[model samples]
Target: MEKWVVALLAMSAYLVFAFIVGVLAGRGRSFWSVSEYTVADRGLGLVLMWFLMGGTVFSAFAFLGGPGWAYSKGAASFYILAYTCLGLLPWYLIGPKVARIGARKNFYTMGEFLGDRYDSRAIQVLVGVISVLAFIQYLTLQIKGMAYVFNVLTEDAIPIWLGALISYGIVIVYVATSGVRGAAWSDVLQGILMLLVAWVVGYTVVYSFHDGVADMFRGIEASRPGFLTVGAEGSGMSPMSYTTILLVSVIGFIMWPHLFTKSFTTTEKKIKQTVLVYPLFAIFLVPILFIGFAAVGVVDPAQLTGPDTILPHLVTHEMGASGIVYGLIGAGALAAAMSSADAITHGGSVSFGRDIIQPLKPDLPERTQIWIMRLSVIAIGTVAYYLSIFGAAGLVQLLVGAYGSIVQFAPAVYGALWWRRGTSTGVIAGLVAGIAVNYYFQLVQPATPLDINAGILGLIVNVVLFVGMSMVTNPAGSRADEYIKA
Candidate 1:
């Protein structure tokens, strides 16, 4: 067989395997039960929870953007490693609390949890809207990654639109059918596959063009001084900027609706266990950064269209001679993209059904609710796919912009668990204020004062509003006390 054909077959084989596994995950489970579909009846074990959390957190960004950052920004890429290690530490505390409340309340979505705490349909709908918006943007980036992988590995034989549709279509099917279980099981496979591929590519590249890891860094330092040190002369970001971004992520990382909702999928002890072992996933990412650094002097920066293309470029130009290598790289990239996309798609559908639609039609039957959620999987996935293929030229910017607003949920979430004085009025007011301030700073005037992230500035305003408004308003009283005691 021809080289491209062989590569395509290898990638195709992986996709087929993923589809079978995802579809089978729902078997013998209660398809009609909302609890079964959304949280697998809250029975997930340690192994499944570990991979689900690990795979979802380490998305296509780990494969593509991680290398891209290292290739373009040098030590600025270390910020990813730093945040990944620290982001889930907060979860160790937050996750168990959330799981306790989630089990007591029978909550399956963040909107549901927040809405019940605040006793307001308005807050629920607002969270649903914000979550869906962020989900689309986040899913768009993953779809784009999947398409890029297929197109580049096949030498452009598969068009961007078709590649995205094919990869994400399978994701949609499994998500609609098997729901969270499908996503969790597939992630186990994907997490393992991508880790292996990352090591293979990272190690091969480091040794292919250089003597060794030490020699590679020595050569880079001698040629380009300070490139490996952030805030240094050649570094891409300032010290203040890096520090603030890291701080914001540590708070916002668990606040993501998809991740927050995971608390309901397993026991509190399992949730804590997952967070404990999560740092190992960060260690696996070290090799991905190696690939980008290996190409620093070898690949011509001027020849590439964007830094994100560095991984594919290296695979095509350097490893193209071996069909097996090309196929594995393609599969690895697709795994990274699909693993996250499945979770986002499942979360979006559940959010749409429980958070947005259910509140609007509170009288809807359970069967109708499940049907709506199933159909929502297709509806949300279709929209994300369209945006990925035809939306703005800068989709990554959209994800960054959405993140600023996601962090706005921190005050409301933390307040619900710890502060008896918190009220629905205060939570709603604070969320709106924080999102508005975040948008203004992030998109309106990105050159934030003091080189700090716009999200942090928004958070400052949010906390002030949250605390002040709560002080003046009536407390949630017994309801708030119940959650705190949980």
Candidate 2:
């Protein structure tokens, strides 16, 4: 069979599997209820929670961007592993508390929790706007990843836009119908498949290039001297950049809306246990870096159009068009893209429907609100699909800015749970200042005022405003007293 034919078969089979899982998940359930659809009735177990969390975190970045970074930048690629492991560590302490509050308050979205905590509709609106924007940006990246895989693996037999539409259209239908439960179950299957493929491809590339793993490293050391060592000379990234990236990712990881909303889907114990086992997921990515290293001498970085396309190019060229292996790689890449997309699409809809719409229109019926949520999923999915097709150089900047700005939620989140003195004025002022600073640094001036990340700079300003404002402003009187009491 032709390689394109084999690739098409592989992707189609994976989509079929996902659709089946999604349909099955919706069966015999009370799909009409908002709680059931959004949070699976808060009844997810440890096993499902583990895979859901792992699968959500390991997106197209792990499969494609991880190795590409390793191949192109040397030791800097280890940032993938460092950030993944460290990012979830603090969640152990924070996850259960958020879960407890969510369960007690019947909160289904992060915006709900923040709004109720602050007793301010404006704060909720601000969070809702940012969540929707960030999630849409995130969805665009996932669509692009899927488009790239389909286009390249099929040798351009399928156009990029059509490929993205087909893949994500399935996600929209399933998520609108089945909700979070459908996303979790499909993630389990995808998570397992992608992990297996990462190991197989990583080892295969090393064995093909050199005698063994040790021999491959030996070759690297001889040619690129210190390439295997940390802080290697001639490495494209500085140690400060490496350390900052790791710190930012780790601290900012759980702040993501999709990850934050998952807290409402499971028990506190299950959430903690899932976090404990989540670090193992980081191990699956180490081999992907090996694939990039294997391509170091064989492939020229300049010849490659972009870092994200390197992995697909390697599999199609190096794997010799073997039907089954090519099929497996395609399946794995599809899993990576689809798993992340479902969660993002779902989270974006929930934020839009609950945080922005329902609050403004208190008279909206539950059934109508549910319909709005479903419609928002399709609308957001279509917008992202079109954006991905056009493509943008600013995507990287947009994502970094979003992540950095979103992490400003850290103070609000942590303050709500532990600190009694935190006030509404403090939280709102801090968030605005942080996001404004982050935006200015990212867009207005490409360089940070002092070589720090824009988000990091924003965070510093956020802290000052938060502490200073709280000292001067009074709380919301009876309303604030009642919320804190609750």
Candidate 3:
């Protein structure tokens, strides 16, 4: 009868539904083979691939941090729109090639793809280390977003840590048991649920105060000018920073280990099709900006401690904590968080097993490797859970930090695919240099020439060093030729 009780019930029900879906989806697959466990035996069709990719991207950030950005940062949030439109275009060109090679080489991890290209375990190890760190960082943000949703909705009936433990625990179990198949099927539910909830809730929040979406924005402009456009001097980020962020995101997004390895889970054509249909997913996310913008003038900024909490605050206060409304919000937010967590957690585990553990043992049985991957979920999940509660960084900060590191992978990945002269030494040097430059810009300087994104600046340095070293160094032509033919 009470609001918290209804919300608790709704969230609990959603968890049960997710667990059932995860387990059932993985039911008939052979669990003994590493490929079966990690890539669903490379049999995912177009629809499942579509939802899996979409659900992975429409993360807890999209639900919480997205609106938070809109609420706090204004026009800077439009960068998400810009990046989403342009990001996957490069994937259409690269994904099919990667998928074809992955099928031939029996590669299920991004590290495997690159390490083989350069004939270097060091490359795999580098990718493994970077990917694991980035995965934990990413999972931490989503878990925080998830926990925040639970804590705010139940009025702390479910505290942040406990809420994370309960929901993320489902993610661990499903991923450990079902592997990528579990993650993909659960994403089907999550992808559809979240898109619907985002639109409904976005419209609801806007219509609450103003007659329509346009009126809502107009009122915000009248009340808080410069909140709708970038470089407006209030909450707007620099235009140079905005455009650079979009450019780096478009280049680096598909380079994420989870998204890159996804190429292995389906056919080459399916990979292309996934990219072709992704713009619709981009369109689906626009209204979430409205939800964030809706709360700007109406809610006092001083009242809430952080912008990340703004959306939840709106649901609890503006929706009058209505049982059904709050319940749907919980279900949707849970979908957003859990969906992304499962893929990331699974990808981290696979990277650890395929890249880290399997190479160390070399002769480890396939079954043993699968077990290591399954157990790696708990290991990585524990780290992410602990960090989610204790980490000092905010949601957007963590996501941005992780993105900065991930884009550095592009040089190695693209070199393996297209550049015949891309030597192992050169790729390794470039990756290290890129990350170093990125971190230096990120923490030490915090300002770049012309206000370009730190990541892009890092990429420029990375590319120069990579190309220069490759020109002087002997090309790994035969290996690259083999890859190209695949």
Query: What's each prediction's TM-score?
Result: 0.98, 0.96, 0.98
Error of 3 at 409 (Å): 1.0
Error of 3 at 378 (Å): 0.9
Q: Give per-residue CA lDDT, model 1, range 342-398, as digits (tens).
A: 999999999999999999999998899999999999999999999889886543456
Local distance difference test, each candidate: 0.89, 0.82, 0.88
Best by lDDT: 1
List ranges where model 2 is wrong by over 4 Å: 229-232, 394-398, 477-486
Q: For model 2, what is the error of residue 136's alpha carbon versus the real structure, in angstroms, after optimal superposition?
A: 0.7
Minimal lDDT window, size 10, model 2: 477-486
Q: Compute the lDDT of residue 326 as modeled in candidate 1.
A: 85
lDDT of 2 by residue, 1-486 (tens): 886788799889998988899768777888778898889999987777888788776787778787777787778788888887777887888777778778888999888988887777888888999999988888888888888888888889889888898889989988999888888888888888899999988898888877887887778778897676656686756666666666667777898978898888987788788878767888778898888888878787777788777788887876564766777788898899899899899999999998999889979888998899999999999888888888675334445666887888888877777666677899999999998987888789857643666777788898888878877887664334433444
Which residue runs of candidate 1 sit more than 4 Å off their true CA positions?
393-396
- Cα RMSD to the true fold for all candidates: 1.2, 1.9, 1.2
TM-score of 3: 0.98
Q: Write the per-residue lDDT of candidate 3 for residues 1-486, one digit (tens) a residue.
A: 998889899889989999999988878788888988889889998999998888877898888888989988988998877777788888888888888888888999998888899988898988998999999999999999888889989988888899999999999999999999999999999888898999988899888877898888888888878878887668579888888888888888898899999889998788888987778988888989888888877888888878988888998876574888888889999999999999999999999998888777889888889889999999999999999998878888788878998999998888887778888888888999999998898889957889998899889989998888878888654799877666
